[model samples]
Each structure stands twice: as C-alpha cells, then as structure tokens.
Target chain A: MSDRGHLKKTAHLAEVPAALEAGPRGAKPRRLVSTRTIVVYGTLFVAAAYYLLPLYVMIVTSLKGMPEIRVGNIFSPPLEITFEPWVKAWSSACTGLNCDGLSRGFWNSVMITVPSTIISIAVASINGYALSNWRFKGADIFFTILIVGAFIPYQVMLYPLVIVLREIGLYGSLAGLVIVHTIFGMPILTLLFRNYFASLPEELFKAARVDGAGFWGIFLKIMVPMSLPIFVVAMILQVTGIWNDFLFGVVFTRPEYYPMTVQLNNIVNSVQGVKEYNVNMAATILTGAFPLLVYFVSGRLFVRGIAAGAVKG
Target chain B: MTGQVTGRATVRAHPGRPSRLTRNLSAKIASIPMMLTAVVVFLGGTLWTVLYSFTSSKLLPRLKFVGLDQYERLWAAPRWLVSIENLAIYGVFSLIFSMVIGFMLAALMDQKIRFENTFRTIFLYPFALSFIVTGLVWQWLLNPEHGIQSVVRAMGWTGFDFNPLYDSSIVIYGILIAALWQGTGLVMCLMLAGLRGIDEDIWKASRVDGIPMWKTYLFVVIPMMRPVFVTTLVIIASGIVRVYDLVVAQTSGGPGIASEVPAKYVYDYMFQAQNLGQGFAASTMMLITVAIIIVPWAYLEFSGGRKRV
Candidate 1:
C-alpha cells in the first residue's frame, strides 16, 4: 500500500501500531514459520507440557473412580469418569476428627481471606499514602526496615507472633489469623501501594493539598478514586496469598478453623484409612481452585502485580 | 517521586517553628502501624529471638541465659544437620534450574510466537496453587505402587525405578522438582519483562551484524538483564530458606526426616516439642542466612545505583 493510503486507514482507526506493540512483553511480530520458528515452538510446547502435566494428572485423577485409579495407569483417560471423589472431597474426606470434609475448611478460608485482605489492604494503602504523600521524619527508615523484614523467614517471626497473639487474648482464633495475615502482608502490600501512589500525577496531589484537603480528605476524595486498578491488584495478591497460606493457617488457627490448604493436607496425609488417590487429588484441586480462578480471571493484572512487587527492589 | 522530595524540603525549612512531633501529626498517626510493625515485630522480634537463643527456655520464653547451650544442642542434632544439608541441596539446585529453565522459556516466548498469552498462562498457573496442593499432586504422581513406577511397568517396561519420595537419599530432589515446577513460572515472567524492556533497535542492530541468536543472548542480553538476575536470585534464595510446607505435605520430612529443612526444624522445636530456645536458635540461624544474602545486595542496589528507575 502507498504511504498516503496507509496513513488514511490508520488515521481513521486512530490506533498507533506502537500502542499494540506495547501490550505484554513477548509476541513481537514475526514473518514466517521457518526452522527457527519450529525450534522455538517445539521448546515452548515441551516446557508447557511439563508445566501442565501435574495439573492434568490432578484433574484426570480427580475424575476417576477409586477402582479405576487403582487399576488403570495414572496417565490414561479414565474409563469411567465420576464426580464422586469431588463430592467426597468437598463433604466427607476425613482429617482426624473432622469427617465433615473440605467444605468446612473452604468456609474457614473464606472467613479468613476476606477480612484479612480488606484490613491488610486498608492499612497498607493508608500507610503507603502517608509515606508517599505525607513525608514525616524517619518514615523511609521504617519503610526500609519493613521491606527488609519481609525477607526474614516466617520461622523467625512465627513463635514471636504467637506470643503476641496470645498476649492480646486472640490466640488460635479467626481474628488472630486475620491479624497475623495483616501483619505479614503489610510489607509487600505497603511497598506495592507506595510505589503506585508515588507514580501518580504529582500535580493532582499538590492541587488537592493546595485546596486545603487534609490527609484523609485528599486520600478518600482523590487518591482512592484514581487508584482503583491498584486496589484490584492488591486484592488479587492478598486473596491468593492469604487463601493459599498453609503455615499461618496451621500455626494461628485451631484445627476446626483450618484453611482449605491445611485441611487438604491433613486429609491426604492422614494414614488412618485406605489411601484414596482419587479423593486426594480431588481435595487438592478443590483447595487450589480459588487461586487458580483468580489467576485465570484477572490474568494480566496478576502478572503486572507480581512484576511491580518484584521490581520495587 | 518528585513530590516526596519537595515535601521533605518544605518540612526541613520549617522544622524548628512547629516542632517535629506536632508537625504532620495526622500522617504520623497514620504511620503508627508501619512504625510498630517495623520497630516491635520486625526489629524487636528478631532481636528478642536472637537473644533468647542463648537461653534454655522450654514451653515458655525465659531470660535465664545459658550462653549458646541451645545452639550447641541444635548443631548436635542429626535432624537439624540433615535439615541444613537438604536446604543446601534444595537451594543450590532450585536456584540454578529455575534460572536456566525460566530464562530459556522466556527467550522462547519472546520469539513472537502465536498464542503467547496462552503459553504464559499455562506456564504460570501452577504457581497459583499452594505448596500443599503441589506436594500432594507430586506425591501421588511419584508414588511407587500406583504412580509413574507402576505406569511405566504396565507399558511393558519391566523394570523402571522412579520413586524419589520413598528414597531417603533423593527425597530432597523430589521436593526440588516440585519447587522448580511451582516457582520457575514467576522467574520466567520476570525474565520476559526484562527482555521486553530492552530496546527493539538493539535486536535489529544484532541481526544486521549477523550475530547468531544464541551468541546475542549470551553476550548482550544476559548482561543487560543483570538486575533482573540478581532480583530473581534473592527471591529464590529467600524462598529456599522457607521450604517447610512443601516438605511437610510431600514427605512430612520423612521417610526418616530426609527432606527436613530449617524452617520445619524451627516449627517442630517451637510448637511440637515445646522447646522454645532451640526453635529460637534455629530461626536465628535462618535470619543469619537471609542476612548473608540480603545485606550486601541491599548495599550494592541502594548505594551504587542511584540512577536506576
């Protein structure tokens, strides 16, 4: 096509090619499927298979009857597919005294994840706002310590947090777990929100301050509205993180209030009965469902969040 | 970024008139959680644990110092020694393999392939699952009687021995495989971001100069991605020190504590055995390990790289 014709078509579309190129990093435009293309695709396909194999096993194993699982190869398609294991995994799998199943743990995870995510994001966003916009003496030092403290293994803080929780009279309760999640989630969430708020248009913040908006006023009226995407990113992070947390859930809550991951582990690892591989796989999938859903639904935002969190260093 | 500096400058100019405490009172109140967490939980908790490591507290934390007795006992335990060794093996292999595989995957994904998003999502979805789920899935897959061993035999291979979870010697490698599976996706995503950040013109220049793709990647691309590599190394190292739940779910640190790691050691000592001092000592050692990895990196990152965005 002529340059003028190309300009005419693109000018009406009002979309620049650079804008399309700036989508997710990979996917540069290529011309032909040559030897190089075959090699690249072959390598990616093999690696993708390696990544997908366990998940496929989980799904197929979960769908099979126990007798089929016992007799057939794990790699084969189930001769007779059944959702009985899924039903059992959700309602009847045993974990010691808990014959009630993973549904109870699922509820417990919901109770823990929702409150923990909201409270943690709330505290971290406000703290991030204060750090980025309202500079006070020695703020960066605390910020640095918090970021560095994130790398401190949970082992170092686990017992100490237990003591603190006990002293506060909230030990082994859902409230204690929520508080624990908030405390641990603070560093990364705070860093995430801080960097985000820092990257915002400074003029809007300055203009709001010049209009005599106080700390909470400017935050509620201006920053919150402007940073909704960040809030979603924070929610994505915390929901997946707090939901998938086995250590804190095991450490902070009683068995009756165990999160899905903990209960799933107990149910699978408990040695009292016959090893139900199908039921075990079903329980694993059920426990993993929430984070996997979040990952698939908010795919790009999830990537952006982790990338932002990692690059903040 | 700019507003913070100007805000600081303004505060500095008017420091004496308002007095530091009253200035930005609302902001300070807002930051109380950050301050308390920083000072009390992070700084104080770490210091308190390290101090208590020298005592003989059991079932409770007491201040009657025993002068490294707990450390001596910790170092003397066979389980703790095994845990340390497992962590070393797990850490080194996980680091090397995750970096290598992650980079290779990222490089391939950068080749303008079709369905890039689909490939990325598939590669990364395993990362979304918890270690508990990862462990269980791998446990079932690695089970000798019903898993890969039996399957291979059924396919007419009479003798194929591929059971890592049962063998005490290679149990750590079993855990390592699961770790790499669950983690490398994040590393790949990070590497892809680094590759994308490179200017396209650079690739054009390399192609014009008749540089082979492998040579270009080795000599030019990898060096340009130094920061990404360092960041990934730190992230992986930190994660390696915290490999507790994966071991617990996969092998429960058995066939006889062969897959035990430091974090598991601390948890068992602190909670199960009610030996607070021993847990403190082991946890403090974990802190020391992280410090060894983090401090110098923090120095180089903050001190010499002010120009970084």
Candidate 2:
C-alpha cells in the first residue's frame, strides 16, 4: 500500500513486485508454490543438506558396529545402531600411551578453557572500560597495536612464546596453554568490550565519575553490572575458540595433557591395529560436542559473538 | 554497524580522556595485561623470531647470525615449494568459492523465507567443530574403501572415482572441501548481516527503476557493502595462512606431503626436526604474507577517516 504513490506516478510501475499489485494492506497473498518460490526453497534445501551431510554421516557411522562399518558404505543407515562405539571412544580408544581415551583430554580442555576464558575476558573488559571511560595517555596506541598484531600469523610468535614459557617455568604445562590463549584472545575481546562499553549511555559513566567513583569502583559496580549480554558473548567466543584449538594444545602442553582436539587427532590418525571407523567417528563427535552444544543452545548469541569477533578488520 | 564501532573507537580529548599516566592508577594496572600482551607477546615475540631467523639456530635459539641462509634453504626445499603451491591453490579457490557461495546463500535467506533460523543453524553448526574434527570427518567421508567412492559406486555408478584425499594431485582440494564446509557459514552470516544492513529503500528504488535484481546486486548492493567484503577477505586470508591442524588430522601432510601448508612446515621444522632457523624463516614468510595483505587494508580503513563509516 505504501508503494501506491509509485504505482500511480512512476512510469516503471509494472516492474514493481507483483505483491504491490494485490493492492492490499499488510501482506500480499500469492500461490503457495510458484516457480520462484520452488527454486529459492529448493536451493536452500540442497544447501542445508550439503551443510548437514557431515554431521549426519558422522552420527550414522558412529552408531554402526565395526563389522557393519566394514561391510556397509558410509552413507547407509545403520541396520542396528549401537552405543558401544560411544562407550569405547569415551573410555578405551587409545592415543599412543593413553588408553583412557578422550575423557582425559576433555577434562584437560575444561581446565584450560575455564581459566583462559575468565582471565581473558576479565582483562579485556577492564581494558575496554579503561579505554572507553578512563582513557590513559598512551592506551590507544597499545590497543591499536594489539588489534593489528592479531592479524600476524601465530606461527611467527609460537617459538618466542615457547622461549618465554620456558623462562617462566610454565612450558609444556597446562598453565602455559592458558596464558597463550589469554594473549591471543586479548585483541578481539578488548575490541569487543571497547565498542560495547563505549556504546553504553555516556550519562552512566559520567554520573559515576561525578559521584567520586574511582577506576575499579565504577568498573566493578557500574560497568560490569550493566554488561551481562556482552560478558555472555565474550564467554561464548572464548570457550568455543579455546576448546577448538589444536596448535597451542600440541605446542604448549605435553602429550599427557593434550586437549580433546589434539588427542582426538592422535587417536584417529595414529595407525593403530584394526582401524576402528565407528570408534573414530564417535571420538570425533565427542571432541566437537561441547562447542556444537554451545552453538545450538546459544543460537542468536553465537551469531552475535562471531559477528562481533570476526568483523575485526 | 561497524560505522558505530569506528566512530566510538576514538574517544575524543574531552571528558573521559585522563590526564597523564599517574592518574587512574588502577586503570593502568588493569591495562597492564593488555600492554604486556601487545608488547611482550605480540610485538616483541614477532621481532624476536624475525631476528633469530638470521641465525643458524638448531634445537635452541642462538644469536649467531648467518644472513639470508635460512631463507635460501627454505625456498630451495621441494616440500616448501609444494606447500606454497598448495596454499596458493587453497587460497584462490577458497576465497572465490567462499564469497560466491556464501553470498548466494545469504541472498536466498534474505528472500523473506520460512525456516530461516533453521537453515542458518544447520549451515553454521559445522563451524563450531574444531578443524581437527572437520578433518577427521572428511577423511572418513573421502576414504576410497567405504566413503563417497563406494557409496557412489553402490548406486550403480561402478566407474565412480571421487577420492580427493588419497590422490596426490587433488588432495589439497579434498582439504579445501572440508575447509569450505566448516567456514562458509560464518561468511554467509556476515553477508546476511550486510544484506540486512542495506536500506530497504534501495531495493524499492531499484524496483521502481526497473533494475533486475542481479544487476542491482552487482552494481549497487555489492559496491555499497565494501567494508563487509573487505573484512571477510581479511578474515579468510588470515585463516588460509594458518591451515595446519586440518591437514595434520586429515592426511598428516601425506599421501607423501602432498597437502603440506606453511604453518605445518613451521611446526614440523621447529618442533619435530628441531631446526629452529628453518621454522623461523618459514614463519617470517608467513608474517610477511599477512602484512602484505593486511597493512594496506588497515591503512585504507584508518587513514580514510570516519567519513566512510
């Protein structure tokens, strides 16, 4: 109905959407199944399948027994789905010296991720609050360097970090990996928090400052209390990112302390006797399960997190 | 959206801008972590590695300089050459396919369709998984014995042969496939946000002007979304450079090192072979590659002022 002006006056009115021709207020009613609708939905359906295929295949393959996997093609639905592979992968599948399977790595990941996420987010939020409200003389320079330095390939810094860790007596320990994650996680989280804190009502910060609140006073009492959504977003990003990491896990921690991703890689690729495809798929899913759970459960928040995190150009 | 961030990035020299470092002591202390990370870890670590690349360091970093020797040896190695080639192939195709397919999916989703959230969730779920998991899943899917090859053959196409992971010539493409599957969802999400950010008035105006949707998209919409596209380009470019664990879990750089990447080269050289100089050189090259792409973009983004935003 808003397009009525264009329809009455414009020479190219015929080119407007057919819905405008229905001349009704609100939505236009059309055939439920048209050629264009079919094509659009059809392409999306095919794409959704392509995207979902691996997860489907992984689940299907993991459910079948090894004997069945040997005989059946990968795509076929299991004749008899079994939870044996899931149990085996979680408990018994070997990664070299460790026959405790993925549980050890999973716990290791939890240990690394919790501390890393908390420390990184805490540091970044304070940095963000400082930059936004308590702007120091040379603070912007360091923040700028941090953002730009994020693009530098981690390979260049990996060795130097090893040296630093060795000097600090944290090398090959889980603590070292936590520090690595915190350092790497800083740039994005800082930027995320910086923009977020800046967007808050300026009156809020000024009001606190006028009330004679100091730096930590305003931050802990005023800023942190008001930014729960942002904290959740940062946590989502760090937990998933730190959990999915392999290079830092492989480099910073000894084999006995490998994270789930690294250990999953080892168990699957180690050329063990009687290559068990079912167990392999189950272990793979187990490794990916946490982040996937977060992604699904958080839904829109996960999108917001990545959008904020990845759009750091 | 980024306009708002860029606008807020530079807090002006009024109200909040604290005078001198002595003031806001707790703020400075709180910022010590950011400073140490930016200085010690990022800047110092990068410089330290670059300096050490000149030395013939092995098993440990030593300061004995042998200028250009490590770089020379790195370029001469056949494996290094192959890694570079694989990166180029992986980079070019990954960029093109990711942009096009991601945009296409986003455009379709922008058509005001049903189940948009369902479709988006399905597409993005793979991105949540680690590269290690993606690699292992694809390795199983591409296995010649019981994966895609046998499945296709079982459908009466006995001549079917689609084993990219096993064949040296196409093995990188195999990795490329998994990479795209895990990645393009993020790109689509970004592009969809960009599409949504485009004022609806433009679409209405284009319709009134009798412009075809494709023409409007190519000439008007894409050009308008320059910042988003550039940001995506940088993200994908940086990611392509660091594709290590995927190759490791999928093929372990084998089918005879056919799928080696620079990141993997650095890891193996430094850690496994204990050849620190070689790893240093390879990693320096990686840094330079990123700089070549990033520096100019950062310059354009910053120097152009907040006018674009």
Candidate 3:
C-alpha cells in the first residue's frame, strides 16, 4: 500500500512539470492517474470486438434457423436452435450433382495438402541445407533468384504454368496441383530453413563433413533434428496456404479433386437462386476449421517461428 | 619455429591436391538436383509465365503470337482498370490500418496484462482462418437485409444502417476491413516479438529518466523496430497483391465491380469469362506492376541498406 502510494506520488510529480509548463497558472491539472492502462484496454476491447464480430455473427447465423437468418437478426438467438444447417453443410448441400456438402472436397484437400506440405517442406529443407552449408559455385546466385522468384505474383505465372502443366500431361491432376504448390511454396520455405540454418553454428556441419558425411547425410543426421522449430513453422504455413488455396486448386485440380475452399466457393457463390446465408456460414466455418484449430493450438510456436526468421524474407 | 612448421605444413598440403579435385567433382555432381529445381521449377515457372503472356493462350496453350494485344485489352477493360484502382486503395488502407491496429494491440498486450495469451490467441485466430472464411463471415455480418444492420434495427435502434458491402462506392473498404482483421494479427505477432526482443536496458533507462511508456514506444522503441516494420510491410504488400479469395468470397466484385481486384479479374476472365488472352495479359500486367513496386524494395532490403539481421 505504501509503495503504491509512493508510486502514485512519483507518477504525479513526473506529470506536473509538463502540466505547469503548458497550462494556465494554478489551473487544476487533469488527473495524472494512469489512463495509459485505460486507453490501452479500451482500444484493445474495441479492436477485439471488431475482430471477433464476424465470428460471432457466423456462429449465431449457423445456430439459427433459416427463417431467423432471413429475418436479419444476426446477433439474436433463434427461437429454435438447430444443427440442421451444419448437418446440411457437411452432408447434403449441393454444389452441382454432388450434394454431399463439403465432405466431398475434404478428402481432396487432405490428399492435396498432405503431399504438397511434405514435398514442399522436403525440397525447401534440402535447398536450405545446400545453400547454408555448402559453399558451392553459384550458390549465392541461385539463392538470389529463388528469393526474387518469391516476390513474383503467382498470378503472373498462372497462365504459363497451365500451359507447362498441360504440356507435361499433368494438367488438371492432383499431381499438377502438388507440383504447383511445391514450386510456389519453395521460396518462402527455402528462405525459412536457410535463415534457420544460417543461424546455426557452422561447426556442426564442419564436424559432420569431417566425419566423412556426405551432403544429404549432414542434412538428415544433423540439420533436420536441430531445425524442428522452423520445420513446424514451415508446416503451419504450408498447410494453411495450400489447404486454403482456392485459385490453384481451381486451376490445377480436376472436378473430382476440388479442394474445400473451391467447393465452399461454389456453394456460397452460386449465382442462381437465393443464397442461403445459414448454409453458407456453416460451410465457411467447416472449411476454415482445420487452419483455425492449428492456429489456436500452435499459435505460440507459430509466433516463435515467425520471430525466428520464418517470415523475415 | 612455428612459422617454419606452418610453411612446411602448407608444402605438405599441396600434395593432396589431386584427391581434392575428386572431392570437388563429387560436390559438383551432388549439386545437380538443386540446380534442376531452381532452373526448372522456380526459374522455369517464371519464364513460362512471361512467355505465355505474349502468346494467345486459352484453356489450352495455343502458341499463336498475340504480341501486345492482350496488354492493350487489359488496359482498356473497365473491370481491369477498376481492379488495379481497387487494389491500390485496398493496399494502402489495409497496410496502414493493419499496422496501426496491430501495433496498438501488440502494445496493449505488451503491458503485461491479464490473459495475454487468450487475447493474443483471439486476435490471431482470424489469421488462421482462410480468407475464404474471413470473407464469408464478414459478408454475412455486413449484409444489409440479414446481418448487423437488421440485427441492430431489430434492437429498436431504427437509425442503424451498416451496409458497406452492398454500397458500390465503399464496398472495397468492407473487404479491406476483413483483410485487416486477418492481417493485423500477423502484424501484432511480429511487433510483439519485436517488442519482446527489445533490450531491457532501454526500458530500464527510460524508466529511470521518468519518461512515460508512450513516449518511449513512439520515439525510442519504434525506431529500433524498423527492420521488423519493414519486413511486415513487405509481407503485407505481397498479401495485398494476392488479394483474391477475400474479394471473391465477400462481394464477388459485386455491387457493380466495386471490389474487382486484379487477381480476381484475371481469374474471372481466365476461367469463367473465357477470355484467356486478356486474362494472361492482365496477369502479366499485375506481375509487372507488382514487380515494379516490389523489385526495388526487395533489392533495397537484400542489398544491405537494412540487412536482415
């Protein structure tokens, strides 16, 4: 209590000189109480409200009956709470003849995402290892090109990629999608692992080399274990990016292999007839659930990974 | 005596030069796969895109040379023009708003507050959700007939009218709001890391001088966090160019193409509108515009003016 009293006195004393210099003589100074905390919390609360308002609306809309949603009371609870829309969104909502809701796209997304993540991360790690550990000729040039390539909007490359994939007879296939994701993901992934590797002490690689380990040997036995944090970060990023990818999935995959985002888009953006807000909300939530789960569970590691140079490039 | 021994060691090391050649050869051989990845995938993809932009390619690649026709159409199209214009506005607003709001959020959380992790997670959960979901959710919330407007009106406040999404003039701002919601979390996280990484001595020194926290953050802390800020700016700029799904999901470039971003325009023409030539041209234009803006920035960033370290 005494320390608190002292803190208040000192805090007041710190502010009085500025007030005395700026305000009228003997004017009652405004309370020098710590409004910093008030302003901070107030701004944060407003921001959080702004951030979470849509999520609240989505949840409320999803829970409400269609009639209630149609009435436009997005914040109000339905007179009858029903999970029917969720059921419909998952099992029976029509996107063309496939009325199996977004579940149709679920397996396709997993197939696309799993391989894309693995191949991209594996390639990136190898690239990162090679660039960081090996002083090979033109290594710097190769790294520069790769980093610059990351900044090129893939939209620019999309038309050309379609042709290239078509020429290789891989166009509109799962493999094509995988290859595209891998190519696009490589820059950021390589940058991530490269930065992580560069930050590591070089002695480890030297020791591995002295032990007669080849390039791959040093990477597998030493670098992989040591780079778990960066790898987790890579996986989080690749998973989210590739899984949520709509354009690539639409362009590269055939109809059967459409990812959930694509399917959700079709369902929600259907230009014909009335748009069902309830079903759309449910489907949107369903489609986003995986990444949201990953974010919530691994947010701390994600932040750490980013701070550790996963996103620095 | 040590110098004489080292000289003798150098002379001895010269004899193993032939074996070193064999090792060098092996290292060269091992680099081939990486070289192929860079040349074929990264460089090849980019080169292919550039080449195709010149061709009159459709759903399938027809290699007929169209020269500057696609580029001409891209410039002439009203939707394409709108897309470019919308992107510029969206980019500026989203970057500034997200950075300011994110820094504010991070600063507030940095005050050693209660439930810091909970608040951080809440702010960040949006980033985890795809732009698709963000767009969908926000679209639903901002819909005039059925969303926040009607909900508030139902609460007996008849003057409540929040329908930015439906208004052609301001719908891009609606999309920007959704983008900022997702993006600010990332900025907050990055800035928080930057804030936490700040040397404790600076804070201690400032406290001893009786400087307030606000002044310290404004004058002292932010300048030190410049690298982090620049990194955030580059990342956010890239996100701006890639602004496809959010606009597609929310407005569908609706209310008369108000939110038509370049990516979406290219996509619509390439896929639905069946104008592949124009689409590729638009794609090329976007690529060039982005390159024009970003290449210089990337060069400056990587060229050691502000080194990554």
Give the TM-score of each candidate: 0.92, 0.92, 0.87
Which pairs of residues collide in model 1?
A: none
Candidate 2 TM-score to native: 0.92
Question: What tens digits encode model 3's per-residue C-alpha lDDT throughout B1-309?
Answer: 122222223446676544433333333454554565567766786676667678787665577998887788778889888888999999889888989988988888887676788788888888777788888888877878876688788889999878899888888988987888777888899889889889766866676576877899999999999978988888788768878988888888988888899988888887788777777777777778778777777788768685645
What root-mean-square deviation over C-alphas does model 3 reach? 5.7
lDDT of each: 0.88, 0.89, 0.79
Q: Mark the regions of model 3 whose C-alpha exceeds 4 Å error after superposition.
A: A1-34, A306-313, B1-34, B55-67, B204-213, B304-309
Per-residue lDDT of candidate 1, residues B52-140 (tens digit): 89988998999999998998998999999999999899999999999999999999998767899999999999888889999999999
Instruction: Give lDDT tens digits, candidate 3, residues A1-313.
Output: 6954774576556656655666675444454335666777787788778778778778778888777766547777667888998999999888877788999898899999999999889988887777777666677787777777777776767766776789999999999999888887877788888888999998888787667666666777899999887889888888887888888988887888999998998899887767778888899999988988887778687666544433322
Clashing pairs in 2: none
Q: Which ten residues in a row have the lowest lDDT in candidate 1 chain A?
A: A10-19
Candidate 1: where is the Cα deviation over 4 Å? A1-33, A310-313, B1-19, B307-309
Top DockQ hit: 2
**Best of the candidates, lDDT:** 2
Candidate 1 matches the true fold with a TM-score of 0.92
i-RMS, every candidate?
5.7, 5.1, 5.8
**lDDT-better candidate, 1 vs 2:** 2
Each model's DockQ?
Answer: 0.49, 0.50, 0.39
